[model samples]
Target: MIASTSASATIVEFTTSHGNFTVNLHDETTPITVSNFLKYINDGDYDNTVIHRVVPDFVMQAGGFEFTGNFPLTAIATDSTIQNEPVYSNVRGTIAMAKVSGNENSATSQWFVNVTDNSAGAPALDTTNGGFTVFGEIIAGMDNVDTITELSLCGTTPMPDYTAEQCSDSTFVPGTENFVTIETVTIIDSTVDTASSLNSVKNTLLSTATPVTPTPTPSSSSSGSIAWLGLFFTGLIALRRRFR
Candidate 1:
C-alpha cells in the first residue's frame, strides 16, 4: 500500500519487504533535495517500487522502477531533475541521489543508501559525479538494510524473496514477491532534529581533511552474517543514467 506524506515531515519511516526503517532528513542543510524527495513521497511516486540495484558492501538503490505483475519493470514517472546539492558526505547508512554519469543535476526520483563508507576511497562518492547528494541517514532498522544486501542477485538486480533454487533456474519468472518492495513510506515525526546533532566533520564534505570513519557500531536489529564480498566499484559507476 502507498503511504501518504505530511507537509512538515522530517522523520520518515520506510516499510519494505525485508523490514521497516526510519530516516532523518537533513532538511536544514539540503532543503532543495529534501523538498524534491518529499514531493515524490507526497505524490505516491514511490509506491510499490523495487530496490532494483544492490552492490554488496557499497549501496542499495531504488525509487526508479516499479513492477506491476510484469517481467520488465516499468520506470516510475519522474519530475524535473533538481540542482546538485552535495552538502553531506556519503557514509554508512546515508541516503543519496543517483544521477547520470557526467551530469550533476539530473537526479529526479532515484536514490541509494550507502551500505558502507564510500566517502573517501577510490570511488569516493563525495568526489564522484559532483558528489552524490546525501540528504538523509538511517536512524533505525539499518539491520534490515544489511539483510536486504545478503539476498542473491539476478544479474545486477537483487531478488529478496527468491530462494537459492529459483535464483539459479533459467526459466524462473519473478512475480511481485521476488523484488524488495517499499510497501509504504510515511512521515512519523516532525519534531525530531537528528540531522542537527550530527558532527560537523561527518555530516559535511566541505572540509579539506579526510572525514573520520566512525567506529563500526551495530544498531539494534538483525545483524547481517555474510562477509563482505569483493567490492564491485564499477557497479557504482554504472548507476549513471541519462534521465530524459
Candidate 2:
C-alpha cells in the first residue's frame, strides 16, 4: 500500500511467499506517489497480486492486477498515471511504479522491483523514454529478491517486452516456479513503533544460536567401559603371574 505524504519514512512490512521484507518509504521526494500507493495498501488493494512479469536480473512487476487475479483491460479502469518522480534512480532493490504506453502519469496500482540498477533505463522526460517512479527501497530480505531474480524467466534476455499484468504461460528459464507473489503488504508506521528492533534481535539470535550436534554421553560411557575392561585384564594378568 502507498502511504500518506505525512507518513514518517516508515518501515513498511511486506510478508511475501518468499519471505518478509522491510522497506523504507521515500515519502519526501514522492509524496503524492507514495500517498496514492499507501491508499491502496490501506484499502487492502495489493494483497494477492501476482508478480506477472519477471525479467531475470532486471525487475519483477505486480500490484496492478486485481486481488482475484485479473488485470484491468481498459486504461481508464486503472487509476490515473502518476507523473514522473525521477529523483530516485532505478537502483537495485528500489520499488518503481509501472505505466502504460503514452501515459507516464497513469501509474496507478502496478509497481515493479528493480532487481538490478538500471539507472540508464530511468524514465526520461523526453518522448523516447518512460521514467519509472521510484518511491521506496527494500531495506531487508534482499536475498528473497535475488532468489526471485535468479529464477527462470520467460525471456532469453534479462529485459523483455513482456509488460502484461500476469504472465502465467510465460515459462521460467529453468522451468521452475520462481515467480514472486504478494501474500500480503502492510504499511508499518515506524514513528508509532520501531518493529525493526525485533528483526535485529532475531538476526542476532539466528547468528549466535548453538549448532545442532549430538551429545557425547554414549561415547564417554563406552570409553569408561573400555578402561574398566583393561583394568580387569591387567588384574587377571597379575593374578596369573602370582600363581606362576
Candidate 3:
C-alpha cells in the first residue's frame, strides 16, 4: 500500500467479500460525520450490515439499520446533527448520508453511494431543501460498487414515488432486495498496524502495488588496473634513478 498524503486524515481500507475499497476520510472537514462512521466501525456494528438498497445511478444505502426487516431501535439516529459539509460536490464515487426531504437534522447511520456524478448535490445543500452530507471520497476500488449495481433485485426494488407535501419515511424499506447482502464489513486502521514497525509488510500487499527490485553494481576489479599502473610507475622511477 502507498503512504497517504497530507490531505488524507486516515486511510480506511474496507475488506469486503465483493472487493476491498480504500476510502480517505476528511475528518478535518467533517469530524462528527467521520466520528459517527468510525463509531460503527469501532463497535463492530457494521460487520454484517447488508447493502439493503441499491438504486442504479443513484446510491447504495447500507449500515446495520434495517437488515431483512429487522431494525435496531437503540441505534441512535443522530443525537445532534452536524451542519452539512458538502464542500466537495456529490460526484460519482462519493460516500454521503441519506436523509428525508423536510428533515435535515435526521441523518442516522444509514448512507448512500452515488452511482452517477450528481452535479446538483455538490458542496452545498439544495437551496430548496437541506441536502445530504458529503463526507468522504472513494479513492480506490470502485469496481465493487459496479458489482453492487449489477446485482439482482426484487420487491419495491426501484425508487418510491413520494407525492408533494408527503412526509417521506427515511426508514421505509421496499419488499425488494436490490443488491447482494454484505456478509461483513471490516474497517482496518492501517496506521496502528505500523506502530510497532516490527510487523513486516506482506508480500501480497506489496506485490499488488509495485515491485521494487534491487539493482546490481560492478565490483572493484577495474581498480586493480590502476594499482598495477601505480606499481609500474614506481618501478620506472626506481630504474630511472639508477640509470641517472
Give the per-residue lDDT digits (tens) of candidate 2, residues 1-244: 3444444435678787667777776665677777777776766777765454444555666675422322221111344455666556666777877654444465677777766655442222112124556777788988876765554443311112332322333231211123355678876664533423332111112223333221212111222211111101122111111100
Q: What's the TM-score of each model vs. the native?
A: 0.78, 0.59, 0.56
Which pairs of residues collide in candidate 1?
A: none
Clashing residue pairs found in predicted model 3: 59-113, 60-113, 86-123, 154-176, 155-176
Residues 121-167 of candidate 1: C-alpha lDDT, one tens digit per residue:
54467765566789889989999999888877765567755666665
| Candidate 1 local lDDT, residue 72 | 58
In angstroms, the error of model 2 at 9 is: 6.6
Q: Which stretches of candidate 3 lie over 4 Å from their true place?
A: 1-9, 64-81, 121-128, 156-179, 189-244
Question: Model 3 compared with the native: what TM-score?
Answer: 0.56
Model 3 lDDT tens row, 1-244: 1222222234566665566776666565566677666665665666655554444555666663424443221132333444554434556777776554445555556666666664342212222124456667676788888776665432212222322222133344333232244454445543422223322111122112222221222112221211211101122111111100
**Distance from true location, Cα of 195 in model 1, Å:** 2.5
Overall lDDT per candidate, in order of appearance: 0.70, 0.49, 0.45
Sorted by TM-score, highest first, which candidate order results? 1, 2, 3
Each candidate's root-mean-square deviation in Å?
A: 8.9, 26.0, 29.6
Worst 10 residues of 3 by lDDT: 235-244
Best by TM-score: 1
Which candidate tops lDDT?
1
lDDT (Cα) of model 1 = 0.70
